[model samples]
Target chain A: ELKVEQNPLFLSMQEGKNYTIYCNYSTTSARLYWYRQDPGKSLESLFVLLSNGAVKQEGRLMASLDTKARLSTLHITAAVHDLSATYFCAVDQGRSGSRLTFGEGTQLTVNP
Target chain B: GAGVSQTPSNKVTEKGKYVELRCDPISGHTALYWYRQSLGQGPEFLIYFQGTGAADDSGLPNDRFFAVRPEGSVSTLKIQRTERGDSAVYLCASSLNAANTGELFFGEGSRLTVL
Candidate 1:
């Protein structure tokens, strides 16, 4: 079984501060995904990291993958209250159809 | 549909009852996935379908949980003899790539509560 662990499961940040959420997996995977979920809403894809050193950024959020280290990171820059949501990182099992194993999500609160 | 669609947005049923959840994936998406999310937890994989066949069902916790995508566009998840532990938001996602490399677009999810 593939295990995924995330640190700082609950995060609270003031406006203009920056923080990073880390995801560590137990096995090798070809794809890593970052997702954001608001309360009672669906998970929305934020970034898709396909390679060992792949990095993607959107607005104030950035994500990167390190396949060799079996780690992925989601960084928030100049955080704002609108950025508050539960974030998750999922790793695809080395198989078809993208069977994903997700880590316990990090709930972020950006306060003004 | 503009996005993955799921039916029965919220369901409340008695324990031991059977329930069915439906998912309508985006048009032209070849891959579909099902996941379960407990309160305050990330979604856990339940099954994945490539076209009309299920390519992977290893994430299913038991035999009572089953899913099928007969025509390759819409899928249904069936649960038999449901227990309280089965209560969760069942999420459906779709991807355009068969190799599982594409970004997954998720549905709003069907929230199931077993009383």
Candidate 2:
């Protein structure tokens, strides 16, 4: 079974602070995805990291993948109040099955 | 619709009743996935459909949960004799293909409550 663990499940950070959410997977995988969800809403895709050392950034958020270590990170740079939400990292275990094993998720609360 | 759509945005039912949830994937998407999310937890994969056939259903908890994508576009998930533990948000997602590289687009989800 593939297991995914995330650190500091609950995070409360003030606006303009920087933080990183870590996602560690138990098995090897070809791709990792970062998603954000607000209360009562579905997930919104943040980044798709496909290869080792792949990094993608948008606005105040950035995501990177290290396949060898079986880890991915979502970094928030200078967070804003509107950025408060739960962030999830999912791993595609290099199988054709298209099943995604997701981390427990990091609930971020950005205080203004 | 511009993105994936799920029916019955919210459902409230008593235990032992049967319920059906619907999903309409984005146009041209060849893969559809069903997931369940409990409060404070991430979504758990329930099933995956490639075209009109289910490519994988291993994540399904039991026979009580079954899904079908008969037309290769629209899909329905049926629950037989629901339980309080079955109450959760049912999310439907679609991807361009069944490949690992494809990114998933999710629906708002159907929040099911079993009393």
Best by DockQ: 1
Compose the digit string of candidate 2's lDDT tens values, residues B14-114: 99999999999999999999999999999999999999999999989999999999999999999999999999999999999977476789999999999
Q: Tens digits of per-residue lDDT for model 1 on A8-103?
A: 899999999999999999987668889999999999999989889999999999999999999999999999999999999988865656888899
True contacts kept of 2: 0.70
Against the true structure, candidate 2 has what lDDT?
A: 0.93
Q: Model 1 — TM-score against the truth?
A: 0.97
Q: Candidate 1 chain A: minimum summed lDDT over ten consecutive residues — where? A: A92-101
Question: Which portions of model 1 show Cα errors greater than 4 Å?
Answer: none
lDDT of 1 by residue, B1-115 (tens): 8999999999999999999999999999999999999999999989989899998898899999999999999999999999999999999999997675668999999999999
RMSD of candidate 1 to true structure, Å: 1.1
Task: For model 1, state the Cα shift of residue B95 in Å.
Answer: 0.7
Q: Which one is best on TM-score?
A: 2
Question: What are the candidates' individual DockQ scores?
Answer: 0.82, 0.80
Query: For residues A4-106, could you state the per-residue lDDT of candidate 2 as single tens digits?
Result: 9999799999999999999999887568999999998999999988899999999999999999998899999999999999999998876785688889999
RMSD of 2: 0.9
When candidate 1 is compared with the true two-chain complex, its DockQ is 0.82
Which residue pairs does candidate 2 place in steric collision?
none
